[model samples]
Target: MFKAVGKYVRAVWYLMTFRIDKASESLRMNPGVVSANYDRIIEEKRGRINQYKDAIAAMIAQEQQKKDKLKEVTAEIEKLEKLKAGAAAKARQVAAKYSGDPTATRNDPEYQKCQTAFSDFSSTLAEKQARATELEADLEGLVENINRHKLQIQTQMRELEKLGEEKHDAVATILSAHEEKQIADLMTGLSQDQTSEELRELRELRQKAAAGARVSRELAGLDTKQAEAEFLEFATNSQANDEFDSLIGLTNNSPETNNDGPESTRIPES
Candidate 1:
């Protein structure tokens, strides 16, 4: 009589904990409502992620344009500097040619021509030098702007990555909750026989997967053997072809013999 009373008490506790309390909780937290909320959160996060990605792409494009502009400015500066150097050299040559001659005055046509050429070259050189300096300053400004944009993009990317991780974790949590709720519902509704049948079906699926894996491994082995056989056959054929070619060349190079009659009737060479 005492053992029967103890068994009845345990059964009541099991029913309260696993069935009644679980049903109460399920009624309190509706699966449809929870799923809707999770979907909304996911959609909002995805929109933010797309916005950040688009901003980063725009920043990258702007940075590229700035870099191209800087390159152009630098090239122009280098070209101007080269031209200035050539102008300076020509001025020096002209000065040297007209130097140490006290009789050669401004009245001399050659000296005047040399002076005009040197003056024009000097003017052009000074103009180019000033333009190069301006371009260098512009290049420096472009570099600074590019660097600023890069830093901004990096910060945004870090934030975007954090947001992505958070979204993934949220999705995982929501999915886990959903699966748990589904399993609880299944347990509440399914009979023992039905549960057993489901387990047997799952076991069969596992067996099929195992068999498929075995077949895949066998097929892979057969493919490897086929490749090896093909390689060996190709090597053997290549070697035979090479030997045949050598034999043919030797036969072709051999001296031709006239066998019109027997050896006694053949003409003898002097």
Candidate 2:
């Protein structure tokens, strides 16, 4: 409440003190009616502005969640992209490793080496394709939500613009109701919208900030980690039944093994 009051004083103090005199002088206005009317306007404006600030804060909270989701999805996307690159690199290496020497059937030592590499690359590629598809779908949904929020904010601003001074009169009616039903009349006269104009303005400011937002690009580096992990995971999966003696190198791939700890999970992945 105090913060809202501070903001109100800063936003309208000049108008109330300096500009109001000019308005009264130019119009040869009735000071008494205007002062009474002005009191209501100030209250409504202060209420509305505070409401706007709260709404904007809420929007920002929602946006932060969405961005976190975006980061997760983007991380997955880079992981897949890196997996794609690794799959191709491994494919070339495997073909080269298995090729040049004829008579080396799948049972030959070198042939077995190349065969395992080829299978790992193919499996990693498949996983990459699936994760990339999921990441794209999540990104599309986030974009839709962002657009919906934008439309809502624009509509709110237009409604606020239409409210004008009608709200002030309504507030006056509320505080000054008489035994003759003046309060009831005032409450009836003030529309819900008149009371909410300030809330809308705060939301608009948040929307503007959101619209200018951009995705961070450094997250693209997740590809290398993704590729390496995918290869390790495939090795782990295949070796789960193998006597390869290598222990299927997936220790680095599990969530439990992350530097941030298992409690890192938060927003939905994009």
Candidate 3:
């Protein structure tokens, strides 16, 4: 018994769920509901697009920052190049002062200072160049990524437009299909439409009204007085017809001028 009760409860739940799902599906098929659902989807997509734009904007800003940093590094490298050239020129001047004495030039503190300055400037320029190269590579990657993201955004926008068109088409198709189904149902005599039912009711009423009128007219004709009146009218018409025939001399009558006699044999004047 317990098992049976549990099964019954499960069946009831299943039936309820099925009914709810069917009702939901029916409501969802409505044009207004479908349109609203599409609108909601569009709004969600727009929100996502806005978020994507924000992210792209951030990437662009970072790319600009990298570009600015690369510019600064490039400028520093140039300045270092100039300083190294000047240091080499100063060392050459010191060597000229040595007048062919290589050992004296090597020991000269001024020459040593020039050498150290050039070495420092060269190292700093190399470091700045490397930094600039890295920044340039970073900028290139960022630009490519930004471009790809922009293309994706454009594609998504086109998809959104397509979705908008699809929404309209879907609604129209659903409405047309619903109308067609109603017509088919009506043709098959399966329609439960209130209008169809009302029209049938009106037709029945009209038929009843016509039948009632006919019955009323038949009952009136069945009246004895009516039949007598018709008979009297027919007699009067017949009398009028005979009088008209007499006036036209179309009636054969016994001549009053005929000789008064019952004799079968009477000589007639030729």
Worst 10 residues of 2 by lDDT: 250-259
Which sections of candidate 2 miss by over 4 Å? 1-103, 169-270
lDDT of 2 by residue, 1-270 (tens): 999999988879876867888976645334346456666655676577667667666766666765676576567656755665665565455556667445534346644655565566557657755765665676567567666766766676665555545555554554454323544555686544554667788899888776554222225655567688999999988756443323455353543334365556566679
- As for candidate 1, its clashing pairs are none
TM-score of 3: 0.80
Q: Say which prediction, candidate 2 or candidate 3, comes out ahead on lDDT.
A: 3
Which TM-score value belongs to model 2? 0.32
Q: Report the lDDT tens digits of candidate 1 across residue range 226-250.
A: 7899999999998677666656774
lDDT (tens digit, per residue) of candidate 3 on 200-264: 89999999999998788788876567788999999999978876776667776323322355653
TM-scores of the models, in the given order? 0.35, 0.32, 0.80
The alpha-carbon RMSD values of the candidates against the true structure, listed in the order shown, are 33.7, 53.3, 6.8
Best model number under TM-score: 3
What are the Cα lDDT values of the candidates? 0.66, 0.61, 0.91
RMSD over all Cα atoms, model 1: 33.7
